[model samples]
Target: MPTTNQYEGIKHIARITTNFEDTCEHCKEHFIDPATATNHYIKEHGYKILYIGPESDISGMEHYHWTVTILGK
Candidate 1:
């Protein structure tokens, strides 16, 4: 079985937002929606979407933002 440590450094992440300007963490490109940001990482950055959920840091605020965590190749 694969160990957790083996995957420790293989994760990449990006942030998508509805209220603020969304920037692609990997390529510094701007996206309008979460889907576009997510697709950018997958198709252009060679990353697979592992999890997408509300960013805990900004949770419970008025704005809606999502953190897209991906597995890198």
Candidate 2:
């Protein structure tokens, strides 16, 4: 699927669900893509990357990062 600059790192994640089942913690918006979720926090709000989900050692890149966009600026 096509992604915007906000969610370009979707592919870089080790384990991210492509299903838009996930909901935003702040806006409570549903998205089928993880990138969309990340972008939502970054664009809609003003959150920074506190930490990228730790990389998976067993699977190699299955880990993802959390967008603290809602928690803080």
Candidate 3:
């Protein structure tokens, strides 16, 4: 289900993890931390929704996949 950002009033829920090797889908750059990826998405891409997979997904060393969607047009 799509959830809203309580702080920014955006429409989407962001799932952050300790997975440090994640990358930004927009910029196609690897991030050492999820928060940095999130900030880049918001400050640069203006994205509202960032859905990250479960911990097991990252722990398994699977390919990182983030589904991004912009909210409020």
Write one digit per residue (lDDT tens) for candidate 3, span 1-73: 9987544655544344563466665567777776676677677867654344444435466666453332221
lDDT of 1 by residue, 6-38 (tens): 355665555455445577765689877767776
User: What ranges in model 1 sit over 4 Å off?
Assistant: 1-11, 17-19, 54-73
The positional error of residue 32 in candidate 2, measured at the CA in angstroms, is 1.9
List the candidates' TM-scores in order: 0.51, 0.43, 0.42
lDDT of each: 0.61, 0.52, 0.55
Question: Which candidate should be chosen as best, given TM-score against the real structure?
Answer: 1
User: Model 3 residue 54 lDDT?
Assistant: 45
lDDT of 2 by residue, 1-73 (tens): 9756655434322223442257766677877777777677678766555444433233475754343222234
**Segments in model 2 whose C-alpha atoms lie over 4 Å from true places:** 1-20, 55-72
Task: Pick the winner on TM-score between candidates 1 and 3.
Answer: 1
Where's the lowest-lDDT run of ten residues in candidate 3?
64-73
What is the alpha-carbon lDDT of model 3 when measured against the actual structure? 0.55
Q: Give the higher-TM-score candidate: 1 or 2.
A: 1
